[model samples]
Target: MAGTYHKDESNTVNRYKHQATYDVDTIHAIVNSTPVLHVSFVPDTSVPVPVVLPMIGQIGHYPSDSESHCYLHGYVSSRLMNLAASPPGIPLCVAATKVDGFVLTLTPNTHNYNYRSAILHGHGTVVSSDEEKLWAMQLVTNSVVPERYENSRVPPDNAEMQSTQILKMRIESASGKVREGVPEDERKDMKRDDVLDSVWTGVIPVYEKLGEPVGGPYNRVKEVPEHVRRFVDGENARRWTYAVEASRKPAPVKRVKKQNQVE
Candidate 1:
Protein backbone atom coordinates (compact mmCIF):
# COMPACT_ATOMS: atom_id res chain seq x y z
CA MET A 1 0.00 0.00 0.00
CA ALA A 2 1.18 3.51 -0.82
CA GLY A 3 1.64 5.49 2.37
CA THR A 4 0.18 8.97 2.59
CA TYR A 5 2.69 11.74 3.20
CA HIS A 6 1.31 14.73 5.02
CA LYS A 7 2.54 17.88 6.70
CA ASP A 8 0.93 19.68 9.63
CA GLU A 9 0.00 23.36 9.86
CA SER A 10 3.57 23.95 11.03
CA ASN A 11 4.88 21.94 8.05
CA THR A 12 6.37 19.40 10.43
CA VAL A 13 5.63 15.72 10.21
CA ASN A 14 3.55 14.46 13.09
CA ARG A 15 4.30 10.83 12.11
CA TYR A 16 7.00 9.10 10.14
CA LYS A 17 5.79 7.68 6.82
CA HIS A 18 8.64 5.30 6.07
CA GLN A 19 11.87 3.94 7.58
CA ALA A 20 14.07 1.76 5.30
CA THR A 21 17.57 2.28 6.68
CA TYR A 22 18.85 -1.22 7.29
CA ASP A 23 17.07 -3.34 4.71
CA VAL A 24 18.34 -2.99 1.15
CA ASP A 25 15.00 -4.19 -0.20
CA THR A 26 13.15 -1.48 1.67
CA ILE A 27 15.52 1.20 0.40
CA HIS A 28 15.00 0.06 -3.17
CA ALA A 29 11.28 0.05 -2.56
CA ILE A 30 11.33 3.70 -1.56
CA VAL A 31 13.56 4.67 -4.50
CA ASN A 32 11.26 3.05 -7.03
CA SER A 33 8.27 4.58 -5.31
CA THR A 34 8.95 8.14 -6.44
CA PRO A 35 9.02 9.28 -10.06
CA VAL A 36 11.12 12.35 -9.39
CA LEU A 37 14.75 12.13 -8.33
CA HIS A 38 16.75 15.07 -6.96
CA VAL A 39 20.13 14.90 -8.67
CA SER A 40 23.38 16.79 -8.00
CA PHE A 41 25.95 16.93 -10.76
CA VAL A 42 29.64 17.89 -10.64
CA PRO A 43 31.50 18.69 -13.84
CA ASP A 44 35.20 18.40 -14.83
CA THR A 45 35.56 22.00 -16.01
CA SER A 46 34.43 25.29 -14.51
CA VAL A 47 31.85 26.76 -16.88
CA PRO A 48 29.21 29.48 -16.85
CA VAL A 49 26.69 26.76 -15.97
CA PRO A 50 27.88 23.55 -14.34
CA VAL A 51 24.59 21.78 -14.06
CA VAL A 52 23.38 20.42 -17.41
CA LEU A 53 19.86 19.06 -17.70
CA PRO A 54 20.40 15.66 -19.27
CA MET A 55 17.88 13.49 -21.16
CA ILE A 56 14.51 13.07 -19.47
CA GLY A 57 12.38 9.93 -19.05
CA GLN A 58 12.52 6.88 -16.80
CA ILE A 59 15.81 5.49 -18.08
CA GLY A 60 16.72 2.90 -15.49
CA HIS A 61 15.80 0.59 -12.67
CA TYR A 62 17.76 -0.39 -9.56
CA PRO A 63 18.23 -3.77 -7.86
CA SER A 64 17.71 -5.69 -11.09
CA ASP A 65 16.07 -9.09 -11.16
CA SER A 66 19.42 -10.74 -10.47
CA GLU A 67 19.90 -8.16 -7.74
CA SER A 68 23.42 -7.57 -9.07
CA HIS A 69 23.23 -5.00 -11.86
CA CYS A 70 20.96 -1.97 -12.30
CA TYR A 71 19.83 -1.22 -15.86
CA LEU A 72 19.92 2.38 -17.16
CA HIS A 73 17.87 3.29 -20.24
CA GLY A 74 18.60 5.88 -23.00
CA TYR A 75 20.77 6.27 -26.06
CA VAL A 76 24.50 5.97 -25.28
CA SER A 77 25.63 9.56 -25.58
CA SER A 78 29.39 9.71 -25.11
CA ARG A 79 29.27 13.19 -23.59
CA LEU A 80 26.76 12.19 -20.93
CA MET A 81 28.24 8.76 -20.06
CA ASN A 82 31.81 10.09 -20.09
CA LEU A 83 30.99 12.30 -17.15
CA ALA A 84 29.38 9.39 -15.30
CA ALA A 85 32.28 7.10 -16.18
CA SER A 86 34.92 9.53 -14.95
CA PRO A 87 37.87 7.91 -13.07
CA PRO A 88 37.33 9.45 -9.63
CA GLY A 89 33.82 8.00 -9.32
CA ILE A 90 30.42 9.63 -9.46
CA PRO A 91 30.52 13.27 -10.64
CA LEU A 92 27.42 14.03 -8.64
CA CYS A 93 25.73 13.17 -5.38
CA VAL A 94 22.06 13.80 -4.69
CA ALA A 95 20.08 13.71 -1.47
CA ALA A 96 17.21 15.31 0.45
CA THR A 97 16.73 16.44 4.04
CA LYS A 98 13.68 17.37 6.09
CA VAL A 99 14.01 19.47 9.23
CA ASP A 100 11.84 17.99 11.98
CA GLY A 101 11.95 20.36 14.95
CA PHE A 102 14.01 22.24 17.51
CA VAL A 103 14.67 20.19 20.62
CA LEU A 104 14.49 22.18 23.81
CA THR A 105 16.27 20.78 26.85
CA LEU A 106 16.74 21.87 30.45
CA THR A 107 20.54 21.55 30.25
CA PRO A 108 23.08 22.04 27.48
CA ASN A 109 23.99 18.35 27.66
CA THR A 110 20.41 17.42 27.08
CA HIS A 111 20.11 19.59 23.97
CA ASN A 112 19.53 17.74 20.69
CA TYR A 113 17.94 18.13 17.24
CA ASN A 114 15.55 16.17 15.05
CA TYR A 115 15.74 15.60 11.29
CA ARG A 116 15.21 13.04 8.51
CA SER A 117 17.60 12.85 5.57
CA ALA A 118 18.38 10.49 2.70
CA ILE A 119 21.62 10.28 0.75
CA LEU A 120 21.81 8.46 -2.63
CA HIS A 121 25.23 7.74 -4.13
CA GLY A 122 25.56 6.36 -7.68
CA HIS A 123 26.30 7.05 -11.37
CA GLY A 124 23.53 8.20 -13.75
CA THR A 125 22.64 7.27 -17.37
CA VAL A 126 20.58 9.28 -19.84
CA VAL A 127 17.05 8.26 -20.82
CA SER A 128 15.93 8.71 -24.48
CA SER A 129 12.20 8.27 -25.06
CA ASP A 130 10.31 11.36 -26.25
CA GLU A 131 7.13 10.37 -24.46
CA GLU A 132 9.11 9.67 -21.30
CA LYS A 133 10.97 12.95 -21.65
CA LEU A 134 7.76 14.96 -21.45
CA TRP A 135 6.60 12.98 -18.46
CA ALA A 136 9.93 13.38 -16.70
CA MET A 137 9.87 17.14 -17.17
CA GLN A 138 6.42 17.29 -15.64
CA LEU A 139 7.54 15.11 -12.73
CA VAL A 140 10.66 17.16 -12.00
CA THR A 141 8.80 20.47 -12.01
CA ASN A 142 5.93 19.23 -9.88
CA SER A 143 8.33 17.61 -7.47
CA VAL A 144 10.03 20.89 -6.64
CA VAL A 145 7.01 23.16 -7.02
CA PRO A 146 3.56 21.67 -6.84
CA GLU A 147 1.23 22.72 -9.74
CA ARG A 148 4.06 24.61 -11.43
CA TYR A 149 3.47 22.94 -14.80
CA GLU A 150 -0.21 23.83 -14.74
CA ASN A 151 0.64 27.53 -14.80
CA SER A 152 3.79 27.56 -16.99
CA ARG A 153 4.20 27.45 -20.76
CA VAL A 154 4.92 24.12 -22.44
CA PRO A 155 8.34 23.40 -24.00
CA PRO A 156 8.53 25.46 -27.24
CA ASP A 157 9.85 22.76 -29.60
CA ASN A 158 11.47 19.35 -29.96
CA ALA A 159 14.98 20.76 -30.27
CA GLU A 160 14.35 22.86 -27.22
CA MET A 161 13.05 19.74 -25.50
CA GLN A 162 15.93 17.53 -26.66
CA SER A 163 18.41 20.07 -25.36
CA THR A 164 17.72 18.80 -21.85
CA GLN A 165 19.27 15.38 -21.15
CA ILE A 166 17.96 13.23 -18.32
CA LEU A 167 20.20 10.94 -16.29
CA LYS A 168 19.13 7.94 -14.23
CA MET A 169 21.29 6.33 -11.59
CA ARG A 170 20.96 2.96 -9.95
CA ILE A 171 20.88 3.25 -6.19
CA GLU A 172 23.90 1.11 -5.21
CA SER A 173 23.89 2.09 -1.58
CA ALA A 174 21.74 4.42 0.50
CA SER A 175 20.60 5.15 4.04
CA GLY A 176 17.99 7.14 5.99
CA LYS A 177 18.19 8.05 9.67
CA VAL A 178 16.42 10.29 12.20
CA ARG A 179 16.78 11.63 15.74
CA GLU A 180 14.07 13.15 17.95
CA GLY A 181 13.25 14.45 21.47
CA VAL A 182 14.55 16.61 24.39
CA PRO A 183 18.01 16.34 25.91
CA GLU A 184 18.67 13.41 28.23
CA ASP A 185 19.99 15.76 30.94
CA GLU A 186 16.58 17.40 31.53
CA ARG A 187 16.10 15.37 34.72
CA LYS A 188 19.28 16.67 36.40
CA ASP A 189 18.74 20.35 35.44
CA MET A 190 15.01 20.43 36.14
CA LYS A 191 15.52 22.25 39.46
CA ARG A 192 18.19 24.74 38.31
CA ASP A 193 16.88 28.36 38.42
CA ASP A 194 19.34 29.63 35.86
CA VAL A 195 18.16 27.00 33.41
CA LEU A 196 14.55 27.99 33.99
CA ASP A 197 15.06 31.77 33.82
CA SER A 198 17.25 31.97 30.72
CA VAL A 199 15.06 33.61 28.08
CA TRP A 200 16.85 31.75 25.29
CA THR A 201 16.55 28.42 27.03
CA GLY A 202 13.67 27.03 25.01
CA VAL A 203 13.67 26.00 21.40
CA ILE A 204 13.53 29.12 19.25
CA PRO A 205 11.27 28.42 16.31
CA VAL A 206 12.59 28.64 12.76
CA TYR A 207 10.47 29.51 9.71
CA GLU A 208 10.66 30.29 6.00
CA LYS A 209 9.78 33.86 4.99
CA LEU A 210 8.65 35.55 1.78
CA GLY A 211 9.32 39.25 1.19
CA GLU A 212 8.09 42.05 -1.09
CA PRO A 213 8.44 41.72 -4.85
CA VAL A 214 10.36 43.93 -7.26
CA GLY A 215 8.76 45.02 -10.53
CA GLY A 216 10.01 43.37 -13.72
CA PRO A 217 10.29 44.22 -17.44
CA TYR A 218 6.54 43.65 -17.89
CA ASN A 219 5.69 45.59 -14.75
CA ARG A 220 4.47 48.54 -16.88
CA VAL A 221 1.17 46.71 -17.40
CA LYS A 222 0.92 43.55 -15.31
CA GLU A 223 0.87 43.65 -11.54
CA VAL A 224 3.59 41.64 -9.79
CA PRO A 225 3.05 37.94 -10.58
CA GLU A 226 0.75 36.24 -8.11
CA HIS A 227 3.57 33.86 -7.23
CA VAL A 228 5.63 36.86 -6.19
CA ARG A 229 2.67 38.67 -4.64
CA ARG A 230 1.57 35.63 -2.65
CA PHE A 231 4.86 35.44 -0.80
CA VAL A 232 4.73 39.12 0.13
CA ASP A 233 1.38 38.68 1.85
CA GLY A 234 1.72 35.13 3.17
CA GLU A 235 2.79 34.32 6.71
CA ASN A 236 6.53 33.67 7.06
CA ALA A 237 7.00 35.00 3.51
CA ARG A 238 9.49 37.77 4.26
CA ARG A 239 12.74 35.93 3.46
CA TRP A 240 12.00 35.31 -0.23
CA THR A 241 10.16 38.61 -0.74
CA TYR A 242 13.05 40.57 0.80
CA ALA A 243 15.59 38.65 -1.32
CA VAL A 244 13.75 39.49 -4.53
CA GLU A 245 13.69 43.19 -3.58
CA ALA A 246 17.41 43.13 -2.69
CA SER A 247 18.34 41.58 -6.05
CA ARG A 248 16.97 44.66 -7.87
CA LYS A 249 19.34 47.10 -6.10
CA PRO A 250 22.72 47.89 -7.64
CA ALA A 251 25.62 45.80 -6.32
CA PRO A 252 28.48 47.45 -4.37
CA VAL A 253 31.73 47.85 -6.26
CA LYS A 254 34.90 46.39 -4.83
CA ARG A 255 37.85 48.69 -3.89
CA VAL A 256 41.03 48.33 -5.92
CA LYS A 257 44.54 48.02 -4.36
CA LYS A 258 47.01 50.94 -4.64
CA GLN A 259 49.86 50.56 -7.19
CA ASN A 260 52.64 51.28 -4.63
CA GLN A 261 52.08 49.50 -1.37
CA VAL A 262 55.08 48.25 0.71
CA GLU A 263 55.82 45.12 -1.32
Candidate 2:
Protein backbone atom coordinates (compact mmCIF):
# COMPACT_ATOMS: atom_id res chain seq x y z
CA MET A 1 0.00 0.00 0.00
CA ALA A 2 2.86 2.39 0.79
CA GLY A 3 4.26 1.85 -2.68
CA THR A 4 0.95 2.79 -4.31
CA TYR A 5 2.09 6.43 -4.42
CA HIS A 6 5.66 7.25 -5.32
CA LYS A 7 6.78 10.49 -3.64
CA ASP A 8 8.49 12.96 -5.93
CA GLU A 9 9.63 16.57 -5.88
CA SER A 10 6.02 17.71 -6.27
CA ASN A 11 4.60 15.76 -3.31
CA THR A 12 7.56 15.45 -0.94
CA VAL A 13 7.59 17.36 2.34
CA ASN A 14 10.80 19.37 2.72
CA ARG A 15 10.22 20.30 6.35
CA TYR A 16 9.18 17.91 9.08
CA LYS A 17 9.68 14.99 6.76
CA HIS A 18 8.70 12.53 9.48
CA GLN A 19 5.12 13.76 9.47
CA ALA A 20 4.65 13.09 5.77
CA THR A 21 2.66 10.04 4.72
CA TYR A 22 2.19 8.45 1.30
CA ASP A 23 -0.13 5.69 2.46
CA VAL A 24 -3.31 5.37 0.44
CA ASP A 25 -5.61 5.08 3.44
CA THR A 26 -4.16 8.14 5.18
CA ILE A 27 -4.38 10.31 2.07
CA HIS A 28 -7.90 9.16 1.26
CA ALA A 29 -9.14 9.68 4.81
CA ILE A 30 -7.82 13.22 5.03
CA VAL A 31 -9.22 14.16 1.65
CA ASN A 32 -12.71 12.84 2.38
CA SER A 33 -12.89 14.15 5.95
CA THR A 34 -13.09 17.82 5.03
CA PRO A 35 -16.27 19.36 3.67
CA VAL A 36 -14.71 21.82 1.25
CA LEU A 37 -11.65 21.44 -0.94
CA HIS A 38 -9.75 24.36 -2.44
CA VAL A 39 -8.98 23.87 -6.11
CA SER A 40 -6.33 26.10 -7.70
CA PHE A 41 -6.29 26.29 -11.47
CA VAL A 42 -5.41 28.61 -14.32
CA PRO A 43 -8.48 29.72 -16.23
CA ASP A 44 -6.65 30.92 -19.37
CA THR A 45 -3.09 31.00 -20.62
CA SER A 46 -3.39 34.70 -21.27
CA VAL A 47 -4.01 35.33 -17.55
CA PRO A 48 -0.92 35.27 -15.31
CA VAL A 49 -2.60 34.32 -12.04
CA PRO A 50 -4.57 31.20 -11.20
CA VAL A 51 -7.96 31.18 -9.52
CA VAL A 52 -8.80 29.34 -6.29
CA LEU A 53 -12.33 28.23 -5.58
CA PRO A 54 -13.97 26.60 -2.54
CA MET A 55 -15.54 23.55 -4.11
CA ILE A 56 -17.46 20.65 -2.61
CA GLY A 57 -16.09 17.39 -3.88
CA GLN A 58 -15.44 13.76 -3.03
CA ILE A 59 -12.54 11.40 -3.67
CA GLY A 60 -13.67 8.08 -5.05
CA HIS A 61 -13.30 5.52 -7.85
CA TYR A 62 -16.00 5.93 -10.44
CA PRO A 63 -17.65 3.22 -12.69
CA SER A 64 -15.93 0.44 -10.77
CA ASP A 65 -12.48 -0.52 -9.41
CA SER A 66 -10.68 2.10 -11.41
CA GLU A 67 -8.10 4.74 -10.52
CA SER A 68 -9.00 7.26 -7.80
CA HIS A 69 -10.16 10.73 -8.86
CA CYS A 70 -11.37 13.85 -7.20
CA TYR A 71 -14.89 14.72 -8.38
CA LEU A 72 -15.90 18.40 -8.33
CA HIS A 73 -19.10 20.18 -9.35
CA GLY A 74 -19.91 23.70 -10.50
CA TYR A 75 -22.18 25.67 -12.78
CA VAL A 76 -22.13 24.72 -16.46
CA SER A 77 -20.90 28.08 -17.66
CA SER A 78 -18.40 28.66 -14.88
CA ARG A 79 -14.88 29.40 -16.01
CA LEU A 80 -13.40 26.59 -13.96
CA MET A 81 -15.78 24.07 -15.45
CA ASN A 82 -15.14 25.41 -18.92
CA LEU A 83 -11.43 25.17 -18.41
CA ALA A 84 -11.80 21.50 -17.53
CA ALA A 85 -13.38 20.90 -20.93
CA SER A 86 -10.01 21.33 -22.61
CA PRO A 87 -8.33 18.35 -24.23
CA PRO A 88 -6.33 16.03 -21.97
CA GLY A 89 -7.54 18.09 -19.00
CA ILE A 90 -6.78 21.21 -16.96
CA PRO A 91 -3.92 21.24 -14.45
CA LEU A 92 -5.03 21.86 -10.89
CA CYS A 93 -4.08 21.34 -7.25
CA VAL A 94 -6.59 20.27 -4.64
CA ALA A 95 -6.13 20.63 -0.86
CA ALA A 96 -8.09 19.76 2.27
CA THR A 97 -7.16 20.15 5.93
CA LYS A 98 -8.62 19.54 9.40
CA VAL A 99 -7.37 21.04 12.67
CA ASP A 100 -7.69 18.99 15.84
CA GLY A 101 -5.89 21.00 18.53
CA PHE A 102 -3.74 24.05 19.27
CA VAL A 103 -0.48 23.31 21.03
CA LEU A 104 0.51 26.04 23.47
CA THR A 105 4.15 25.44 24.26
CA LEU A 106 6.26 27.15 26.90
CA THR A 107 8.00 29.13 24.19
CA PRO A 108 6.25 30.54 21.17
CA ASN A 109 8.82 29.07 18.82
CA THR A 110 7.74 25.51 19.57
CA HIS A 111 4.02 26.16 19.26
CA ASN A 112 2.27 23.99 16.71
CA TYR A 113 -1.06 22.52 15.70
CA ASN A 114 -2.49 19.01 15.49
CA TYR A 115 -3.78 18.71 11.98
CA ARG A 116 -4.33 16.42 8.99
CA SER A 117 -3.96 17.68 5.43
CA ALA A 118 -3.78 16.17 1.97
CA ILE A 119 -2.72 17.62 -1.37
CA LEU A 120 -3.56 16.09 -4.73
CA HIS A 121 -2.08 17.20 -8.03
CA GLY A 122 -3.54 16.12 -11.35
CA HIS A 123 -5.29 17.03 -14.58
CA GLY A 124 -9.08 17.44 -14.46
CA THR A 125 -11.34 16.57 -17.36
CA VAL A 126 -14.98 17.39 -17.66
CA VAL A 127 -17.06 14.21 -17.40
CA SER A 128 -18.90 13.98 -20.75
CA SER A 129 -20.82 10.75 -20.50
CA ASP A 130 -24.17 11.10 -18.73
CA GLU A 131 -23.79 7.71 -17.01
CA GLU A 132 -20.44 8.51 -15.40
CA LYS A 133 -21.49 12.10 -14.75
CA LEU A 134 -24.52 10.98 -12.80
CA TRP A 135 -22.42 8.60 -10.72
CA ALA A 136 -19.99 11.39 -9.86
CA MET A 137 -22.85 13.77 -9.09
CA GLN A 138 -24.46 11.35 -6.66
CA LEU A 139 -21.13 10.68 -4.96
CA VAL A 140 -20.59 14.41 -4.42
CA THR A 141 -24.20 15.08 -3.37
CA ASN A 142 -24.17 12.38 -0.73
CA SER A 143 -20.90 13.74 0.59
CA VAL A 144 -22.44 17.19 1.05
CA VAL A 145 -25.49 15.83 2.85
CA PRO A 146 -25.56 12.11 3.45
CA GLU A 147 -28.53 10.30 1.88
CA ARG A 148 -29.60 13.55 0.19
CA TYR A 149 -29.67 12.04 -3.31
CA GLU A 150 -31.97 9.17 -2.38
CA ASN A 151 -34.18 11.23 -0.04
CA SER A 152 -34.74 14.07 -2.48
CA ARG A 153 -35.43 14.02 -6.21
CA VAL A 154 -32.62 12.35 -8.09
CA PRO A 155 -31.62 11.72 -11.72
CA PRO A 156 -32.00 15.44 -12.06
CA ASP A 157 -34.30 16.96 -14.68
CA ASN A 158 -32.84 17.49 -18.13
CA ALA A 159 -32.66 21.26 -17.62
CA GLU A 160 -30.99 20.92 -14.24
CA MET A 161 -28.50 18.40 -15.55
CA GLN A 162 -27.67 20.63 -18.49
CA SER A 163 -26.93 23.56 -16.17
CA THR A 164 -24.59 21.59 -13.88
CA GLN A 165 -21.17 20.22 -14.74
CA ILE A 166 -18.88 17.76 -12.99
CA LEU A 167 -15.12 17.54 -13.32
CA LYS A 168 -13.19 14.38 -12.54
CA MET A 169 -9.47 14.76 -11.89
CA ARG A 170 -7.23 11.75 -12.35
CA ILE A 171 -4.99 11.99 -9.29
CA GLU A 172 -1.42 11.32 -10.31
CA SER A 173 0.39 11.84 -7.05
CA ALA A 174 -0.79 12.69 -3.54
CA SER A 175 0.56 13.07 0.00
CA GLY A 176 -0.83 13.51 3.49
CA LYS A 177 0.80 15.34 6.43
CA VAL A 178 -0.38 14.84 9.98
CA ARG A 179 0.62 16.23 13.38
CA GLU A 180 -0.71 14.61 16.52
CA GLY A 181 0.01 14.31 20.26
CA VAL A 182 1.08 17.12 22.64
CA PRO A 183 3.55 19.96 22.34
CA GLU A 184 7.32 19.44 22.39
CA ASP A 185 9.19 22.12 24.33
CA GLU A 186 12.92 22.61 24.17
CA ARG A 187 14.95 20.79 26.83
CA LYS A 188 16.53 24.01 28.08
CA ASP A 189 13.18 25.67 28.54
CA MET A 190 11.70 22.66 30.33
CA LYS A 191 14.66 22.59 32.74
CA ARG A 192 14.28 26.23 33.67
CA ASP A 193 12.66 26.54 37.10
CA ASP A 194 11.21 29.98 36.45
CA VAL A 195 9.58 28.86 33.24
CA LEU A 196 8.19 25.70 34.79
CA ASP A 197 6.62 27.58 37.67
CA SER A 198 5.31 30.57 35.76
CA VAL A 199 4.26 29.20 32.39
CA TRP A 200 1.63 26.62 31.59
CA THR A 201 1.93 24.53 28.44
CA GLY A 202 -0.52 22.07 26.93
CA VAL A 203 -2.77 21.50 24.00
CA ILE A 204 -6.20 23.09 23.76
CA PRO A 205 -8.49 20.57 22.10
CA VAL A 206 -10.20 22.05 19.09
CA TYR A 207 -12.87 20.36 17.04
CA GLU A 208 -15.57 21.32 14.54
CA LYS A 209 -18.94 20.17 15.79
CA LEU A 210 -22.32 20.05 14.14
CA GLY A 211 -24.82 22.20 15.95
CA GLU A 212 -28.52 21.52 16.41
CA PRO A 213 -30.38 21.43 13.13
CA VAL A 214 -33.18 23.85 12.44
CA GLY A 215 -35.99 23.27 9.96
CA GLY A 216 -36.91 25.88 7.38
CA PRO A 217 -40.29 27.36 6.53
CA TYR A 218 -42.80 25.47 4.37
CA ASN A 219 -41.52 22.33 6.06
CA ARG A 220 -44.02 19.63 6.82
CA VAL A 221 -41.72 17.46 8.98
CA LYS A 222 -42.51 18.06 12.62
CA GLU A 223 -39.36 16.51 14.08
CA VAL A 224 -35.87 16.11 12.78
CA PRO A 225 -35.52 12.77 10.98
CA GLU A 226 -33.57 10.02 12.74
CA HIS A 227 -31.09 9.84 9.92
CA VAL A 228 -30.14 13.48 10.23
CA ARG A 229 -30.04 13.31 14.01
CA ARG A 230 -27.81 10.24 13.93
CA PHE A 231 -25.44 11.84 11.48
CA VAL A 232 -24.98 14.90 13.66
CA ASP A 233 -24.49 12.96 16.88
CA GLY A 234 -22.10 10.49 15.28
CA GLU A 235 -19.90 13.19 13.75
CA ASN A 236 -19.79 15.27 16.91
CA ALA A 237 -18.84 12.31 19.09
CA ARG A 238 -16.19 11.02 16.68
CA ARG A 239 -14.49 14.39 16.14
CA TRP A 240 -14.59 15.33 19.81
CA THR A 241 -13.01 12.02 20.79
CA TYR A 242 -10.31 12.40 18.15
CA ALA A 243 -9.40 15.89 19.33
CA VAL A 244 -9.28 14.87 22.97
CA GLU A 245 -7.15 11.82 22.26
CA ALA A 246 -4.77 13.67 19.98
CA SER A 247 -4.12 16.23 22.69
CA ARG A 248 -3.51 13.67 25.40
CA LYS A 249 -0.70 11.34 24.31
CA PRO A 250 0.89 9.44 21.49
CA ALA A 251 0.02 5.89 20.58
CA PRO A 252 2.18 3.06 21.78
CA VAL A 253 4.96 2.17 19.39
CA LYS A 254 4.63 -1.15 17.62
CA ARG A 255 7.50 -3.61 17.49
CA VAL A 256 8.49 -5.48 14.36
CA LYS A 257 10.76 -8.57 14.25
CA LYS A 258 12.79 -10.31 11.60
CA GLN A 259 11.53 -13.60 10.16
CA ASN A 260 14.56 -15.54 11.43
CA GLN A 261 14.82 -13.76 14.79
CA VAL A 262 18.37 -12.60 13.98
CA GLU A 263 18.71 -10.83 17.33
Best by lDDT: 2
lDDT of 2: 0.83
Task: Give per-residue CA lDDT, model 2, range 1-263, as digits (tens).
Answer: 23557889789766666677888888888888789888888887797798788888888887574577888876534666677778678898999999999998889898989999999999998888888888888898888668878877677989977767888888889988888887888789989999989988888999988999989998888989877888899999999999999998862222354487433
**C-alpha local distance difference test of each model:** 0.46, 0.83
Candidate 2: segments with Cα more than 4 A from true spot: 1-3, 46-48, 75-78, 251-263
TM-score of each: 0.49, 0.90
Among these predictions, the greatest TM-score belongs to 2
Find the 10 residues in a row with the least total lDDT in model 1: 54-63
Q: How far is candidate 2 from the true structure (C-alpha RMSD, Å)?
A: 5.3
Error of 1 at 51 (Å): 13
Per-residue lDDT tens digits for candidate 1, residues 1-263, read: 22222232322322332322434443344343333335556554566345533221222223223332222223435655677554343444445444444555665565644444554555665545666556666655544344566657776477857676555565455555444333234444667777677724433333344446566665564666665455346534543443333333332222343587322
Q: How does model 1 fare in lDDT?
A: 0.46
Model 2 clash tally?
0
